[model samples]
Target chain A: MVCIMKFDNEKCGYCGACTSVCPNSSLELTENKLIIETDKCDDCKRCSIVCPLGAFLEVEGN
Target chain B: MKYDVIVVGGRIGGSVSSLFASKNDLDVLMIEKQPEIGVPLQCAEATSEETFQTIGIKPSNRYICSEIHGAELHSPDGNHFRMYPHNDEIGYILDRKVFDKSIAIQSAKAGTDIMVKTTVKDLIIREGKVKGVIAKHLGRTMEIEADLVIAADGVGSNVARMAGIDTLFGTKDIGSCVQYKMVGMDVDPNLMQIYFGNEIAPGGYVWIFPNEDGVTNVGVGIRNHKKTAYHYLNKFLSNFEATPVEMNIGGVPLSGTVDKTYTDGLLVVGDAAGHVDPLTGGGIHLTVICAKIAGEVAAEAIKGEDISAEFLKRYEERWNDKVGNVIKKSLKYRKVLDKLNDKELNALAKFMKGRDLDSITSASLLGLVKESPSLVRHLKDII
Candidate 1:
């Protein structure tokens, strides 16, 4: 099972804080927003802490 | 036993006051309650770059984090307002711990003695004039004597209270905030995001500020009516996979200046002065601005040996003139924002869509007010 990733685009500051901490490279900042590459996310939870806006969240459990 | 000026609290406002007082060749003593100068931080640490210019204080590499060009405001109903950079008016979110300590260091360098872990218990008044303070330090009680006392203490200031000033802040006038400092995340290092809504932060907003390295400062502060600043952050983060590195909880005053910030032989600055931005809960800039004024006034009062209420009134007048109008205006704006519901917020967002906004030239936030004219109906009451 894969947890669905949610991104509040408005809360994303495009700081790239999520991408750099994501061990799976699932998070990427593109054009001032955090985009989740669904296949790359391992539900590591790294993206959430580094995300300053609380913009990203996990909707489901794997 | 005697000093020209004594500043209570070692936060931004207190530090600023101490720095200026010492620089002017006055004898100064700065006291911090905590063992460390800036521990258990209480502020969001965001300030406008324009403020730094007025004080001629450059951002040191230690605490200076990311420089933000503009801000994005998000409504709970999937609405957003983004402001872009145009003028030289960029804002910066700082490393608050470092920023605060630097103020103390600067003050010390200017010849002020900073005492840490010194808790002030009460004010020492003589002849109906504020004289000094009684404090406890290192398992011993001591009295610090000074000609004038300046409360650089936080919102619930003991110094102000001890001076017979009403330090009680109504629930409607305060903002409760909770934040996290995460180290493993990455961000643009330039842009900031703010979220608003009943579910997220009622009468207040959530924010994400990115700094240098990989640290990101994320948090929320709702008006006094709302009590879920922490829960909202958790709920909002539930959708994302992340681990907390550090958690911070605090409050910001959003109701404009306190009714009374000064009295005979005593003055208040920083959070104690209630100089925060009523619209957004940002106070560092305003507090420091007022601190500069407070320090100057305190020094002058001490030199003239006239710490009367009328003499100290100068600080209030000077600070009010500098940012009083803007803060007062923002407080009125806050009233409209607090009463807004989801549907109303969406309509306001729709009204602001596609409007060219320059940070300086345009009233970026007022666009929402135009959409909801009901906000204007109470303008007479608010302003």
Candidate 2:
């Protein structure tokens, strides 16, 4: 299964809100970007729920 | 470069710790990952007058956008009450871009060195002790050594985690927040408005704090929910006629203070340490208090020539002695609050809407909880 979490950089405020709520600790916020550890994420959509900007979305994985 | 103390993240916690540490005669160096000292604001910027008093500076109008008089709280069913000040000053809405930088300036003026755009990529540990940091700036990586390290690195808290501390926040214990700095918002410029309901914010609340005339900071914070904070924020905004000037977003640790804020040669403060009120999700004041303690404790540890975990534990002890119980009590209260549904909240608000805000106490609040057996069970755990 592929990582189902999709990120839209344009909508990201880079505020680290998604990083704080990532239950799996799979999200990282570097100074310039928010990085996702897709393999570690369970596709829980916690990021989608907490993201204020809808930057994270769910997609069917190949 | 070597220093007596290295403070990571140059916001309130880092700057305050550096300020006090430098004043105590420590060679302090503060490193911020941002190119600017304060940019891309994440906070709602409402803080008390005590915050300024703690830092020994007058609250300047340059940074203070509006002086608040009191707060107005609204329940889902439209029942509301006002929280008036009992001889104490209310608070101020700050221009955080200016406010955060001013504090960093104060810390620098006190003889602390600062490097902006420098990120602490890793920590240098020797014999189970943190000795320094591996930092990156402009694609250049360098190692800076220090005797003691204070991690005020906000919610991401990579520095503290690198030093073997678990700064990760649970979904339930953290709040996902999104705020918009808005204009043409017709809110009372002197009152902070707070709305609560499960559908509105789930475990958190929404705020419409007036910044200046015709401008407001409208935001929403929700916890352990499937809906995004932005969705709720937009839903709330539909009730008002306002235009967004900028949108700010971040995570808040409402899990009470983190366990073990101190470990060999390293001390954690601010959001990284979970120095925020569990009930209100307010952190600036608590961060100010704990950061100062972290700084003073760091100075003492350096002077005592003991940078070990045992010595650094004093940082934890001192801060806990100051505001630890508040966080603990707030956590308990938050637990009880989280158990309350919209119906219970509406019922509680109905009973208190016309009562004197100053007359309400925990005992009286407990009496109100008696109306709902579900919350009473949780309330007993706190009482």
Q: B277, model 2: CA deviation in Å?
A: 0.6
Worst 10 residues of 2 chain B by lDDT: B374-383
Candidate 2 C-alpha lDDT tens digits along B130-149:
99999988899999999999
Please name the candidate that would achieve the greatest DockQ relative to the true structure.
Answer: 2
TM-score of each: 0.80, 0.93
All models: lDDT? 0.74, 0.86
After TM-score superposition, what is the CA distance of residue B55 in candidate 1 from its true location, in Å?
2.9
Q: After superposition, how far is residue B249 of candidate 1 from its true place, in Å?
A: 1.0
State which docking tier applies to candidate 2.
medium
Question: How well is each residue in B1-383 modelled by candidate 1, as lDDT tens digits?
Answer: 88888899887888889888887778999988777777766666788876677566887778888888877777778888777756758788888888888878888989999888887877889998888899878768888898899997776565786787765555556676678876655556788888778888776788888877777788877654423466677877776555677877665667778778899889989777788889988888888889998888887887888899998999999999999998988887887777778767777666555654432233544654676666445443643
User: Considering summed lDDT, which 10 consecutive residues are worst modelled in model 1 chain A?
Assistant: A25-34
* Fold similarity of candidate 1's chain A to the true chain A, as a TM-score: 0.73
